[model samples]
Structures are given as structure tokens and as C-alpha cells.
Target: MKIPFLGGRQALLDPTLVAPMSTAARPELTGGRRIGVLVQHGFTGNPASMRPWAQDLAERGYAVEMPLLPGHGTRWQDLNKVTWDDWVATVEGALDKLVAENDAVVAVGLSMGGALCLRLAADHGDDLAGIVVVNAAVDTLRKDVKLLPVLKHAVPAMPGIANDIKKPGADEHGYPMTPLRAAASMFAGYAELRRDLPRITIPVLFFRSAEDHVVDISSSRAINAGLSSKDFEERVLEDSYHVATLDHDAPRIFAESAEFIERVTREQQG
Candidate 1:
């Protein structure tokens, strides 16, 4: 089932063909120390999935930066050329810059973006004020996922996993295909983050969809089981799917995240 907007036309394959919603930056409010919020999108997805959430933060006077991950927001074939390290480096650099500019920084992410946020929290625990993750994917139960190492070489692409929202007419503007080699690299990153979850001591607000088709609830269970964060909180999204940020509960996620950022910033900076 191909959507009309994302037709399988050749024009959809070029990274430079159109401007991506990622890499957006909002200036800090005047005369006040603003909290910085860095929002990230999921694997095979672009900043389109994260824009509304980031925009809400910007409107609330927080400095916002949403970066397009390396090889993402482009053709799926492009993802084959990059490794997971490249993705992590892009996000890490953004987080570092946000930390340098603001009094506090909160990391917000969805799906694999959540995994990257966990990685940031683990490595840069002292620098982060808090974290918000929606439908974070830490592990997978697919039996075929085990064949990725070999399948990556054999299969270049697979069906896409974009627009997993319950809302109608919502588009995430993601790649139409899924790159196999890049997925293998993502899994490697997930495994490493799972091992380092104990290092993430910052406050976390985790959201999981009750009926997600892309990532299972077990992924959230694994993250909660491994996290050492004393301030960890989990909420089940009853009205959404994998892309809760763009679904029926988007407003709830945005409003709650803003509140979480405010509460954590006050507690930490006061």
C-alpha cells in the first residue's frame, strides 16, 4: 500500500530533492536562561515525526534543535552507506552544542531516537537535565531480526515502517524502504545501550503505545528493567500506535513533555 504523497517515484530517492524538517533550530528567548530541548526522530523516519513536538517546545520558550540523523530523511538506499556510529555522532554533537548554549538540556526522542537518547543519557549523564522517550525501541522479538547480519549483505531493502499512526492523513515523510545493513548497525547500537542503561541516572519520562505494530512492549520492559534512573516514570499510551507523537495522543505527549522539562529543570537548577 503506497501513499499518494510518497509515491515510489524516482524523485523520492534523492536527499537534496527537497528540504528535510530535521536540523531545525529556534533561538533562545531574550533576557532569560532558556532550557534547551533536542528532539530526535526514529529509524527510517525524519524530523517530520518530531517537528510538532519540537515546535511546541519552541513556543514554550525553550531553545529547540531537531537534527536529521545521518543517512535519514533521504532515500533508503542512502542509509546503506552509513553506520550506526555516524547516527550517534550526529546526535551527540547536537546534544553537546545544546548543553553549551543552555542552562539545562532535555533530550526527547521516539522509537530508535529513544535509544539514541538513552545512549546520550548514559554517556553524558551529568550534562542532561532530563529525558522524554515515546515508543522507544530497545529490543526486538522478530525471529528474522537475528538473520540481519547475513541478510544485510543479501537484501538491500525491505518494506518501510513509516506512518504507524492511528490518525488518518498523518504522514511522517520517511523513507519508503528499510535499509538492511543500516538496521543491523542500529541493532548493534541497541545492544550496547542496553548494556549501559545502568549509567543513565537522569530523570526519564517514558511513553509506550499499547498497540504498536513496529516495536513490541518487551522493548520498553527491557529498558525499564535495565535503567538505574531513580526518577524513571512510564505511561502507557492507550490511544496511539508506534508513532504516538503524530497520533491521537500527540497533544498529551507534547504537553506532558513540556511539563516534565519544566519540573526537572526547576528541581535540578533550583
Candidate 2:
């Protein structure tokens, strides 16, 4: 008997097409400042979704690190065995390394990657200059999520939420199926994240796709209501979806993020 979405066969992905390799760049000092940036991809997503953005930053002479999260950049079935803590630990380790090596560090993330960045800011704000989150999720209104605890035990996977981009031919190369246990762990941690939002006192640059299909507006609203940062800013992506980092507004995201990083890092120096 074959389960609907239980195994690696459900992915049907061409591994080469995914561009799953991790990205790292250690450039010469920019304006005599040793600045670093940590770029992160979302849940079930590899470095493919964030490579372009990470590359753009690296070109600007900043140290950049985009690590492949455990259980990602591989078969979807492997994700089922990992928990949310595994994802957070990966990004946190990257941030720690950057902080120790640079005068200032900025963390940038997409989707669930954004949530991990926020967690870092909350716990390590003093070590970070700022953070940028694109289509980040902190809270959800999806009633079905309440059943995740039970559903995950019965079903191995569900329909995927990847590639929610408005641009034609844009692919995040994420999993074709959502592993139930992994997803359940992600949503389960949101409450704790929300509670710690007040701890994120550093500057935050938030990007929300106007037509996002994966993460809803409730997340932005929650961030707006919960953050204690006076430097919080939200920009709307008019022509993109959940994967705005890879959508038509990608250039805008890169340009603005570069400016944000420069300004925040400079400000930290003073």
C-alpha cells in the first residue's frame, strides 16, 4: 500500500535544478568596517531561494553566510524527522559566527527563515545591528493548524506550500510535499516567538508581499503589535507573492536591504 505523500518519491524534484549548495562569502572590509550578513532560506527550502540575494550582498564586499538548514536541500521525507529547534540552531550558529568576526552583523531571511532571524534578534539583539524579514510568519489564522499535533502522527506529509511566486518561471526549488511533523513543529514554536517579540529591540526591516498566498496578513499585524523596536519599518511588495525574494520585486528587496545594512552598521559604529 502506497501512502499519498509519505516518501521521497512525492518530491519529484531534479536535484541539480534545486541549487541546494550553501553560500558563503568573506569579502575585504567595506569602508574599513568588518560587516557581516546572515541570509537564510525558509522551511523545506534550500539555499536556492536565497542565493541571489546572498550573492548580491557578497558583491558589496560584506561577509555573507547562507547555511543549508538540516533536513533541507534533501528529500522531503528527511524533513519529517527534524524539529523546529534544529532549524533555529542552524541559523543561530551562523549569526554567532558572523558576530564574532565582524564589527556589525545584519540578519536577513525569507518566510520561515524570517522567523528564525527574529528569534535571533530577540535572543541576541545586542550582537546584531538589525534584521530584515520577507514574508515572515509569527502567527497564523489557519484553523487547520490546530489539528497538526494529531494529523502529523497519522499522515506523513501534505500538499506543499512552496513556489508561491507571482512571477512566471520562478521556482524556490523547495519540497513538493510538506512533511507533517516538521510543519507541526514550526507552527508550534510561533507562540513562544510571539511572546519574545518585545526582546527584539534592534532595527527591523519587514517586507510583506501584497498578494502573498502562503503567509497571511495576520503575521504582519502581529509583528506590528508585538515589536518594541522604534526602528521597525514595513514595505509592501506590489508585484510579488510569498517568495518575494525571488519574485519581480527582488531587485527592490536587494537594493533596500543593502542600504538598510549600511546605514544600520554605520549607526552602530557611532
lDDT of 2 at 246: 88
Candidate 2, residue 137: lDDT = 94
Residue ranges of candidate 1 with Cα displaced over 4 Å? 1-10, 13-31
lDDT of each prediction vs. the true structure?
0.84, 0.87
What is candidate 2's local distance difference test score? 0.87
lDDT of 1 at 11: 36
For every candidate in turn, the CA RMSD to the true structure comes to 2.8, 3.2
Q: Per-residue alpha-carbon lDDT of model 2 for 227-252, expressed as tens digits?
A: 99999999999999899988999999
Cα lDDT over the full model 1: 0.84
Cα-based TM-score, every candidate: 0.92, 0.93
Alpha-carbon deviation at 78 in model 1, angstroms: 0.0
- Residues 70-179 of candidate 1 have per-residue lDDT tens digits of 88765677889998899889889888888878788899999999989998999998889899999999899888988999999889989889888899988777777889
User: What value does the lDDT take at residue 39 in candidate 1?
Assistant: 90
Per-residue lDDT, model 2, residue 235, is 97
